[model samples]
Structures are given as C-alpha cells and as structure tokens.
Target: MQAFIKEPSKHSHAPDPDRLHIIRLKNEIKLRGTSSAEAPSTILFDVLRSTPLTAAFGLPTNDALLQTISRERPAIQLDHHVRLPLILRQTDRGESFILYEVDSMVIFTCDKNLSGLVFVPVGDVLKAYSSLVNDFDDEDYLLLDYFERV
Candidate 1:
C-alpha cells in the first residue's frame, strides 16, 4: 500500500507552541491514491508529514512495538486482563483515545509526553474528535507517529 501525508495549512509565524499533532491511517485504501485519470499518484493527510524510515521503528525485535508504546504511554497503567483496542486521535485541544488503559470509555489527552499525558475520566470531549481517526485495535499502538515533535 502507498502512503502520503499533507500538513495543516497556515505558516506558524510563531506556530503553536502547544504542539499540534494528528494521526495517519496506514493500510487504508484511502491512502492508496485513486484509480482514475487526473488522480494524484500519492495520498496525503493534511495533518501528517512523511516520516523518515529511521523513525518508523528502531527495530521490530523482541517487543519493540510494545516497548515503544510503553515509552510513550508509561502512565496508561495497563494490564493483561484488559484486552480492548484504544483508538488514538488528534485534537486541537490535544491527543485523545478510547481503550482499556483507563478502565473503559474513550480518553481525551492533552499531551502524550511523560508529564503531559492527562486522563479524562468522563466527558464529551472525545466524541467531538470523531473525524480525527479511523477506529483501530489496541493489540498494538503507535507512540512515535504524530506524538513525536519535529
């Protein structure tokens, strides 16, 4: 599958010091370009940038993915008994998701950094983020995607 990314418009004369972030769905046919004349050869997300190959992952060996997720979400405090997928979304207010990490229900996080990851125990803030991400399983989650700043 082919993948491309488009960054949000607006030159940051001073940009957002808050760290704007978004999620890009891979494997989705939506990112495979289109099958028509005049169609672009690449697909892109206005909020995502093409990631460097070296940044995809250090190496997919011995719990590499899990280790990475843990590194990004050390505060989630997950357990083996909790087996549910958490969908991560980007928001103007911050980062968000629904998962077994905080028991149940979706969580809207303002930050994913070690000190910035805050859990919204209950609220309607995350529902408004419906347009930000496609549903995804939590068997494995990405920590580097947009969570990492340039």
Candidate 2:
C-alpha cells in the first residue's frame, strides 16, 4: 500500500479584504431592502473621516451640518444615466453643494453651480464607478475639462 500526502496550493484565489468588505456591505443593503439602513450612514462617515480630502480640503463635519444630513434621507438622482444618491445642502457660505456616493466607497462632492467637483476616496476605494457614468459624456466640454483638472 502506498500513502500520498497532499500539499496545499501556492496560489490563493481569495478576494481582497476591501473588496470583501464592499461585497458584505452590498449584501447587507440588499437584505435590508433599502439603502437607508444604518450601514449607509456608518459607511459614509467612516469613509468621509478617513479620506484625505476631508483632512486636506477641510471638509465640513460640524454638528449642525451632520445633523442636517442625518435629518433626512438623500434623494437619488439620475445623471447621465448613472443613479446617484445625493445629499444636497447649503454651505455656511450659502453655496449649494451635493455629496453623492460613488462606487460604494468614495463620495464625490459637486457644486450645484458647476464650479468644481471633488473626489474623495474611502479606504481602498475603486475607480470602477467611473464606467457607470461613461466619463460624463453628457457634460459640456468646460465641465469635462474641469473634471479632468480635478
């Protein structure tokens, strides 16, 4: 009789930890049947606080602003065929701004007046969401150029 010992494979196909986290988040959202679950806010805050944009650009997190955000669920909008859940708020300076989640990881902030857009990536956020918008094809050249500059 011959006995054979099986060795473990050198290649592992496990998903990346960040990707796994996103998958779990999506599952949780699906299970809840609405994106308004506790997960979205928690995930949003987690991403916001950790992003370099917040630290470097002085992203507002004051209690009043946060309270306004928590007061109501954001309205989802379809822009250029992309569905984006947006929280529209008036800044302290009376400027209208929109904060929308991108790719379930990063949040993109845009000025309602088409001033500029800021891309804030959460921890290990992916760029896969760009494909959904088709690179903002419906936007004007100046706006597209502004995005390119950002």
Candidate 3:
C-alpha cells in the first residue's frame, strides 16, 4: 500500500505562526483526551502561564476557571434567543473539544469537528458558533485550517 501525501494549494496563503501554535496546542489536547484526570482546561492553564499573552488576558492557572466553565452547560448562543449546547467530548469519534472565553469578547473553540482552531469574536454579547462557522469566508475572523490539505 502506498502512503498518500497531501500538499497545500499553490494559490493558498501561508499559515500564520500564532495560529499554527494554537492548532498544535489543540492537537495535543485531542491526542491526550480530556478527562477529569487529564482535562485540557488544566493543560490550557499551564500553557497560558508561560505564554506572553497571559498578562494581557489575565488567565489564572486555577480551578476557578474550570469551575466557571463547568458551572453552566456549554452552549453557544447565536442570537438573543438561540443557543446550542456543545458536547465536551465525542466518545465515538475519540475527539476532545474545549472552548475558552477570553477578554474583549473573544472566544477560542477547538475541536476535531472542524479539524482545527476557530476564533470567534462575540463583542460583549454571545453568539452562535454556527454563525461564525458560517462566516468562514469572511476575512475578519481568525481560522486556522490545520488539517485541510490539497
């Protein structure tokens, strides 16, 4: 059997370094699997501790963050009345997903569903994950297509 190799398109732009970092982090989390004993929230806390953006984001490496995340059911609000619950893990697919809400109404959502990192800007109010996913064509959002190949 031959191992197939895929390459990026010649016309496609180069990947962003920061976005690449985020993708790598997400991949690591997926591979390890996030359980109570090995949750990505803990790993993310550690990563943010060493990251330069830590001071700006004020991400504390503590259980409070995790508690806040768990206090409410994970859901993405698309509009004033529409909200969709998100699964933390897809057991059948062996995929671990996580979402972090950062300052300035920015949200970091990583999942094998999209096979990469997705940054959504909610701007003071929450919105639907699908709304941003639908705007993948827009240039304003930061979307790193780490798994897509040509």
Candidate 4:
C-alpha cells in the first residue's frame, strides 16, 4: 500500500481526542474508516478513498469546511435500521449544459494533492443524475447551487 500523508491536524482546537474529526459523519456518525467489527482496514480505506463520490468531492473532507452527515448511535440494533441520504449540490456553471458534479472534482488527499475541490451532497448528486437524458431540458440547477454556496 502507498503511504498517504495526513493533512495538518485541524482538530487540535478540540481538547477531546474522541471529538477529533477523523472522518465526517454519514447518517449514523461513521468515521472515514470502519468499526471494531471490520477486520480489514485496507479494504475499508480503499472503499472510502476510491469511491467516485470522494474523488469528486474529496474524502476525509477538508478542515476549513466539512459536510456533516450526522452522529452515530450507541445502540447497534437501532443504528442498523437507519439510513441517511447523501445530497450533492453544484454552484459552478461550465460548458457542459448538464454537468455531473462528481465528474468535476477529484478525491481529497492528505498528501497535499488538491486536485479537485468540488463536492456534492449525496442526495443531490443522485437527484441530478436520476433523470439522466444528457440534455439540459430544464433548469436542474435552479435550487441546487445555493446548497453549495451557502
């Protein structure tokens, strides 16, 4: 496995080690990696770092601004049934009448490769491409852009 350098610690402001932002939450407050149940850390890391969603928006999100999903549940049974929606929004306009936000951004890098800075909320990304005809028949971006800018 290749070594990836971690970004400068930004969670230093938080005095509690458990409160550190190792990974932004997704639904039930999952860290970027997995829990004690997961046996292989390598596979867990790959699934997160390689996902196109991360590639586009970058994973282990930046310290400056992070898209928070939510907190984890202490109860395993209750957590198992819960599902959170991922919403993505794009504010930038480009040549492509219809642009999939994921295609525009690159994965986040701890090693200082800021290749792509764009990120999309999971729900929005799915919604934008859900219709998928490829032509900008209607203004899909009407309300979407605001989610990213503000």
- Per-prediction backbone clash count: 3, 0, 3, 13
lDDT of 3 by residue, 18-78 (tens): 6555545444444443333455476556655554552433433446545543443233345
Comparing candidate 1 with candidate 2, which one achieves the higher TM-score?
2
lDDT for each residue of candidate 4 in 1-150, tens digit (9 for 90 to 100): 999998868556535333222333231224532343432334344444534352334335432212232122133332232422121122234222223224345332221112122365776675554433243334745533554466
> Each candidate's lDDT (Cα)?
0.35, 0.46, 0.45, 0.36
The alpha-carbon lDDT assigned to residue 39 of candidate 1 equals 23
Q: Please give, for residues 20-106, the per-residue lDDT of candidate 2 as tens digits.
A: 444443344344334454644564555445444424333334443344445444455656846442333445455444455454554
Which regions in candidate 1 have their CA more than 4 angstroms from the true location?
1-49, 53-63, 76-150
TM-score for all models, in order of appearance: 0.14, 0.20, 0.24, 0.16
Best by lDDT: 2
Model 3 regions more than 4 Å off: 1-11, 34-36, 50-150
Residue 21's lDDT within candidate 4 is 26
Residue 129 displacement in candidate 2 (angstroms): 56
Residues 1-150 of candidate 1 have per-residue lDDT tens digits of 998897766854554322222123232223242222222222232212453334344323424333433333324433475633233344433455332244555444333332323344467435423322334234213633444342
* TM accuracy, model 1: 0.14
